[model samples]
Target: MTSAQPSGEIFELQADPEVVDKAALEGQLPGSPLSMHRVAKGHFRVVVSGLRTDAMLRYRFRVHRKDLGRWIQVSDPFAWQLDASRQRWSTRAIGLEDATRKKARPLPRRPTFDQLVIYELCPREVVPKATRYADLVTAPTGAQPRFGSIFRAITRRIRSGYYDQLGVTALELMPILAQGWRRATPQGVGRPFESPTERPPWGYQAMSWYAVNGDYGTAAELVELIDAAHARGLAVLADVSLEHGYGGKENGLVTDLWPRWRVPRPKNRWGLLELDLAAPGAFPFVVGGLRRLLVDLGFDGLRLDWTEKVPPKTWKRVVAEVRRFAPEAILISENPTLPLITEAGFDGTWDFFFHWEAPLLLRRVYRNWDGLAKRLVSTQRKLVENLEGRAYPPHGAKRVAGIDPAKGPPVVRYLESHDLPRVARRRVRWQHGGGHLMDVDGDGKTPDWLNHGSQATSRLGATLLATLPGAILLFQGQEHGADDELIWAHDPLESRRDAKTFGHYQRLLKLRARLPVLRQNDLRVLLSDDKRHVLAYSRGEDPARGDDDRIVVVLNFAPQAVRRLRIPMPSPGRWRDLLGGKTYPCGKELTLHLPLAGSLLLQKLGKRQTLGKRQTLGKRQTLGKRQTRAKTKDCEPARYARHASKPVSTSR
Candidate 1:
């Protein structure tokens, strides 16, 4: 193997650890190692002939830098294994037979971009003791304990109809590559289940691009997990940090291989050395590492973290390389600048602008219905335009090709994520006027519904998040109404899961799955009234489904119940509230009663039925033995009777 180290004055391969240790005991220069000859100005190479192909080899480079007097220990820049457990700058070589023994299953069929409902989670958090890949997927035995494996637990849950109930088709995991930090105890070796202050947080700071984090299990274990997920018809996406490498004096390729381009950028907030992708050897190395993850590791897709910093040319090349190897793999970007990033071969980008704006609308922070309505309509229009291949003028990039607006919005929509405070936690704080809302009562338990009303508030947000026009993403614990913020290094208590919150999320997801029209990009703001604290919108096209397969959503963001509110009808017919199974006959408009912090999802059933006045119908008619009523009041238009039943008023 050959490598170019610009500062290299002398370089030797220390293949045998015992030989190197024996030289150290002699207190003399380690001589007669596998000598590397200078092949080029800065390139060095060595060929170790007649080595056993199946042997596990440990090697490092003893480089005598021209600038630095002392020899610096460096690992191979292209090493497939950098075992941090054996200490930093360590490399391990395994036999091809061992590495290829467990063949990764073929890529499974995945949902289309428009049909994705993603669930994001941290492996460590999902299964507290999941330090191995098998730990995540291993099923528990009666002889073993609970939470044995995430994969096994999930499989059981799925078979038992737990995960399928949530209606998410894909799973996105946080970075699982070799991370820089490990749990170092006084006894010596570090553990993964240490306290947050004790161990490094999330695996954001990667030490090796090609190696998996051993703490989270082995390469084979990960393959097993992926295989299980694929078998269960779930697409798995990995969150990858390609913008930079380990920072702050970490002795790895990021710091050792490319000194000139490894300089830290002032704009890098993560205190990491930013890779100059344009630099020689950088692009190939990065792209090769990504390929290994997709082609070898068997990931269904990649969520490129913080891709905004990467140059466009570099992105194009990286994406081209990725697609060449894995054309069906989904590529999503965490870049805030969309359309521009989407043009660079990404299937979608995180909708941060939409995420930020959504909370304001939910909280009624602007406090004006007219303004809110206009903003909602305008934002939807802009999103539609962008999805239709219209580039933002400021980006100066051409419209994205192959974008079909009718397919749906090409973005990942979420109310909560790893970067943001959990929606439930934020709701609790907001309700308590920014104070601590996790206070427990006399029973040593926090009431699910506090005086601040976070449960209802969170449910309202969930409805919007699931029903809005875009691919949906749910952070871990968000489904169960976890009020505590996710602390990466610590394990979440079992007590945090709320059945009510879980039920609410399940229903919303089920509703989303039931209504195909909800997945379409067609969104229209039918009504927005600040004074009444009501916002009404419709999704889906009437042309596609002549009957009202279209869904109309009505949201009440007020503290008081709204009575006799008139909502415009798309077409005079029987509007059925899917949640309550109640129907209302309408001419041009329908009067509704929405309670505080409520929502109504109405689907047009069919054309209205007209009855002669002489043949008076009963006050209440039974549909499927369920009572449906028509109540009218004086001063209201004498038209078809609107059911007085407020379906959206049911308690969450």
Candidate 2:
């Protein structure tokens, strides 16, 4: 094969000569067939004139397999758009002129990294079933259930202020890129089913990095959805799986042609074919795909999936190149106990520690409540320290060349995610023993204790999550008490108890936005009571300064109400409960009555006012009847005995 600069439209295909004997470009140019010459070993190229650079170009490539001995049509590995029905490729090869004509727009205005509240949703799942099948009979084969209308529906809702009301600043879209549809056996071999089955709801099994999922929607529709979100002041983040690709029958680009791109032994836990980043041209291929998603299409950021599988050196290079061009783009990692935060220069990573350990504390399963309290306080301090770059440099602090002192890291905090079970559906297995406590009930089994007060427990978790420092995430339907598990075949947007749970989240988010101290990095543990199952923390720029901006959050995790609970305050002032709209005067210590599974958001009052008669705070709404009695025998002082010599507050 030889190389040359062509004057007109050029098409190229890189393949193994042993696999492909011949190739041709089948386009609309009215030619019988445009034969492609072998420009290099295992490489073919064709150039044609009379093609309009401004118009959308549609074409397909046909290759004659050496084994099959007949020409067959296959998709281009680098196609921007694929006509799933015809199995064709589309592009406008205007070259440099195209870039000049369509200048990339600046990213939409978004809140600071610390203030981000991300709402994750799958595009196909958000739309109703009836809507997806409306045009099924009239549409061509494999073209029914088009998601373009769903994109428009979401865009309409965004324009209608739905997201603003929900108080989320960003939308994290699940994978929409072309994905593998082939089923895999228990032995991890991709196979074709004799009969068709419903496609998976999630898009984790990626087929083409560049092509938009035709089943999901057209590229134009996706662009419109993102643009509309931006207009509504909502940043859009794309979740990309760079660790592995679909190794099914559909991935002919790698299987039949570029087999060298696949690793000798797949390393991904998902049993998919992992990409060999060390191979020739692999780095540029991945980088080009990233540029397409972030530069050509305007995505505010990316939530990289399975970041642990990728090498830190490769991630560092990828992140450096992306940051060089898109400086404001936020890159998040998805490794549980991520060790690459600073090395890869990601803005944030999933807080798996919170996801795994928070339930243990909430369930009160520990024998020593003091140990649990200490663990909770220390975990929170570690998170804060990581974000502030005190213990480790923040995500973006380490670039390709050296440390970048200007960039600070954010944290990704959530109770429910795509990987986690919903709070209502979660069954607490022995976090230590790995055995869930189950009870038989009329031929059906249910988890004991966890079923009781799930709603209240959910609210408690949300309260603690929202007040902590991080980019908080609320999975789809999680804010509205959707108890069903994530079904790959079917996902409904609405739930039975939407009003109550939705209202709680709406109010909680609005309160977080209204309070400036909640968005800051400073945190101090004010109370961690073991006996009463109560905890309190203060958030502010400086709680020791005793300013009016200081905010204290008190939580009661007990199954029953606790009376005369006292928590020390930073200063002598009148504090108001923002959630319940109650006020109390405090000198150094504040005493209060809290309901079962209750929480309080207290903000210091600048001036003194007459306090109303003390009333018991409202009890949080619960779901089940099962309750666990707390052990109140072991009594402790207001502060930990180990910290008796220190001040009342523990600021890390």
Candidate 3:
């Protein structure tokens, strides 16, 4: 162990008395323990070979302070595991050999970067209250304790086809590592942690990097969850906080190992200590933890939390080490620092700007279509620039990509996330506050569309989200349009689910899965009109291919239907509405009537694939003139010939 201190001090390794006796009884070690030798000033080393790997062993260091009065006992900062049965931390062996020797499970086949539909859920919140780890209460007999396990709950959901029905390709779990707050029973659930006076239900304040949070489950149970998710064809991405370590009384590594390198002033509410990335031994320690999470735990990927606070070089190194250990594992950042972080092998980052801008534009809260169009164009341009390796400016720059179509969208799009206010809450507020209630008939009464738990609003937003070119992220309960604001302490188990909203999200997700163009990056804005509050876009291969599979999306932000709106067509003869199954014929332009807060997905139809009357017209045209004349002369007029001669109606 290396430590920085003043000169002339002795360091000693102290194995637990019981562990030494157990090792002796098992004939795994010699009776005498090794003495520490000073390798450098304030740095010491002890070569203890032939230690038992099969048993749990505890150890600490006896080192003299700079004052050199009394030797202090401290746990190893780099200990792979910590014994949490006691009040104070003690180093534990954790059967490293067995853990490493267990047959490594192969990761499940992951979705392509563009095809990912991420469902971010806190495992602790999804299960019933009585089953949650933090909500476990003593039995009526007061002898036994019962609680919920994330493993079992997630396994149940997977078996129930909840995620499958939602078309979720990936599951992004909140942190499951050892966190700061203690697990409280149902009787003590409302009680707060002493230092913070409030516990964050989301496990962001990591106390131990190596140990799995016992409250969540054992390490083996966590592996079970990963394996089950994989079996269900879902990639699991863990949220890890590498930016800082927990502080206050829960400061585990910062207080024990790298006290000198801890930066003052908490970076967030958890009272976390920022680590100095440049400091000696810091990078390796962080990388070691990452290896433990990825290599040891078998996760498919990691979502690095609050990456902006970390030095770019440090992050690059961490990502490199992660890739080295698990080459196929995906690396994503919560913040969109693309090209910057992407250069370090990051697949994508969260599109916070899209999360913000989409709501404003779609809600008609900000009705400047020109400004919205400019922003969209600018964002798309920068995303392309980033994908092509062009340099851009620093933090909060406009050059960052939002939701756009590309081979791999640099940013992941979401209407709601843990970091943002719930979309349902916003919808509820807008509906109650007289924000153009989308009453199509203008009856001056609250419409059914407004009463179905914001189903219509959610459908509109979800349509925009699913159709956009990017990896999509859905927050927990977002599928059901959950209205509860996700505060740090709020329990997810209590959140209400709306069946109508859930069905809408499921349909949108299934649509996204079925449509290949929605996953591609090729996009062209066909029209964006401010006065009409309408935006139209097309996604497909290069416009040069007339027969390439193309989907035209029209979104109406206004509260009234826009009739006979002429939208430019890409050589459209017949177009089928993929969602509504209605077909419309077009020449150079197509006249459309879009309902308020409604969206239309139109796919160009091939001549041979035209349906209903359009197919009859095609057949009549293909017939020879002799056959047509023979039939027409006998019958006066052919039914298909008359149908072909009439102009195709544009009514929906």
Ranking by lDDT: 2, 3, 1
Candidate 1 clashes between residue pairs 3 or more apart in a chain or in different chains: 131-216, 132-217, 133-217, 136-150, 136-151, 137-151, 137-152, 183-190, 369-530
Clashes of each: 9, 4, 3
User: Candidate 2: minimum summed lDDT over ten consecutive residues — where?
Assistant: 627-636
Model 3, residue 436: C-alpha shift (Å)? 28
Better of 1 and 3 by lDDT: 3
Per residue, candidate 1 scores C-alpha lDDT tens digits across 172-257 of 87887766554322232243433323435466677667766644544555677777677777788999988565664433444454
Which 10 consecutive residues of model 1 have the lowest summed lDDT?
Answer: 20-29
TM-score of each: 0.74, 0.77, 0.72
Clashing pairs in 3: 131-148, 405-521, 406-521
What TM-score does prediction 3 earn? 0.72
> What's the ranking of the predictions by TM-score, best on top?
2, 1, 3
lDDT of 1: 0.58
